[model samples]
Target: MNMSPKSFLFLFLFLFSLAFTYGQEGLPRLRISENQRFMITEDCEPFFWMADTAWELFHRCDREEAAFYLKKRAEQGFNVVQAVALAEIDGLQSPNPYGETPLIGLDPRQPNPAYFSHVDKVVEMAAAEGIYIALLPTWGDKVFTHSWGKGPEVFTEENARSFGKWIGNRYKDQSNIIWVIGGDRNPREGTSDVAIWRALAAGIVEGTGGQDKALMTFHPQPAGPGGSSNWFHNDEWLDFNMHQTGHCANQPTYQKISYDYNLQPVKPTLDGEPLYEDHPNCFNAKELGYSLPEDIRRIMYWNVFAGAFGQTYGCHDVWQMYTTDREGINGPLRPWKVALDLPMANQMKHLKNLMLSRPFLTRIPAPEMIPANQEDNTDFVIATRDSEGSYAMVYFPTGQSKAVNCKPLNSRLLKVTWYDPRTGNQIDAGIISKAPSNTFVPPSSGGKGHDWVLILDAV
Candidate 1:
């Protein structure tokens, strides 16, 4: 049967509209909580943004490999995957597994549709797995190329906006998309970096319709004091704040989390990058050695107890999808598939469950409850509580018994328990008297692996 050209055009347009509609309506869009401290779903449900860094997902993995990674992470209770469109490991020069580069002639404004089609497929696959894609439009190298990244330094203030708008439009309808700007590079004051990122953000807002269209944040390179907030915290487009915190052990990262939490203009914050499961601690394998699972577990507890809404877990190997055939970032021990089951990845759910087990929305940082000097201690004791004083948790890094100021808590009778962050087990420690201050000994003590969280549930 012969078909009319007009009929073909009409059919194509109709199918495209259907796809666009599904993209928008398929997942619940995330929004900032009313308290401006956490993420909530479109239906007003608490959303714990447990994410895994898969910076090389689109660059290295084919469709099958990408899906496999998503399935595994979703099962591990990660609701978000932090990935990149233009990856960091020489992404512009090297083609993807499909032999397609993201841009035509390394020009940000002239994105190659063929290359982006793979990115589209990866994001769609993530959505299908009930996962949000925390997408970086381009890695930091593409922007600053400051110290390490290979530079052809392709982005400018003008093209940054154009690229941002185009990429934003392509995924405007995909509900699971969370735009993360500035990649891993921090914008300097004197340079055009800030202007370019702002332009890019403006383009995204334009493409997606408005500032309220999606959740947005920046990923910074462990720049202390404020991290992303050092620059963009006051910006309208930034929905939350994130910090890398680098890959060192005994970092006292809770200090960073608490700093952001108490900023003049409050915005939600979390550790975008913490010490990875097996990264060379301080990037010195010869001396400090690879990070243990305990290193990551402590950092996670430290950040959350200090008032981070959620945590992002990473394994040095898995983020790059390391395989025997490829060169490693920092001496990866296993392939990405094996790295998926690394202790911290599976154990991350325990933190998610612990947070959700409590009264989530009402929680606030209780730094005053912890001894001021302990704030900088490697055996750091940190605390958080229901803003209403309904419940509280204090983490003992190395399980050191410390006197906690109990006067601030309104509860007269408190039921205390020792929560093992490593095992997700809560052991009863009997009722406690609420007074000006109290000393509670942790069930386990004396080293890094002996971490415990003292939980107080008030009647």
Candidate 2:
């Protein structure tokens, strides 16, 4: 068969497409659900976004260390690994174990192929383990250097676009890639900084050849109530909203997720950077105590019940790849390798299992189903229910007895149980007749560490 020149070219392109897609066939491609409030697989299966923060995975660790770290997270039921390409903390100056920096002379336009090849291997490894990489092209320092972040500010609008396109084209074919912009810095409105990030977002889209292959979002600084919301909520390029509730003790992050949940144009939201398991409260170990396992559990349950699509778990030691040889930032208690086996890391999988065990894609925040309590302290309770009101969950931060308004469930009898966030075990609390208001005391009460989740289902 003598093929024409045009036909020959078309055949070559077709074969290339097949090869590209075949390489990614085993990976799960993710997208925003039709309702725009949660994530689902390409086949519309519910995907609970359980993530762990390891921002320095590529910048700090070698292939062997990276593999170990990833394996532990995979075993812990973490489906997403959030990392940065051009990392924070003098990443531009320091080289990886391979002795390569991401940029030549700290130029955003000049990404070193050798350095990015390491990142590629890491991403591929994560995908092989059924983990998606929520990749930040560059940390916030590259564009908006807020609060003494180590940065030379290498990205202008033009270079930002070129860098983003380069990264987008590089990872476009990967099924497990999620493009997250704005690493801990929000571009001030009416400034050139905003244009820089917007250009980067556009460049990434263009680099993907206009295919929305990966979901996109931003990680703003933990400064105010608004997170990425105040900057890019309405941006066409943004697919979801991410907030950094920060490492403060008892930060009312549920309020933040609740606010984003009720936005006019509904978009999925999550606490991308919650309080880490062992980090100091408010970044001051001397003044404030370290965050206990219960502190981490409280934030995780509170955010999810208050309408967050998922939660990201962080550790002060893990995020920076801390070691005794290196001076610890924010008082890292242990090395990254040791921090990997912390109880909180083991316990995080329970949240994903619990959510998936129940109905997916049909849950909504239902605070009205639980009556308000008069707790003088900041500790409080939050509630959520299936859209049909067949199932509901309430979280008590301090284990105080609270009255619930079961009238919203509309069921004759409700089967209640106590869910232990620490162990992911459930204890039956007996059945109750649905009423206008019912008060239930937890197994224990009045301690910062005693947190409980009340699970109710129609009987």
Best by lDDT: 1
lDDT of each: 0.89, 0.87
Error of 2 at 155 (Å): 0.3
**1-459: candidate 2 lDDT, tens digit per residue:** 999999999999999999888756667689899999999998889999999999999999999999999988998899999999999978898899999999987888899999999999999989877899999998988776777778868899999999989999999888899999989886776779888988899889988877466479999878566678887889878899999988887677788898899886889999999999789998888989899888788888888998888889998899999999998887899999999889889999888888877787889998786666444344778888888878888888888888888876758999999988878899998999988888888888778777888888988
Per-candidate TM-scores read 0.92, 0.92
Q: Over all chains combined, what TM-score does candidate 1 have? A: 0.92
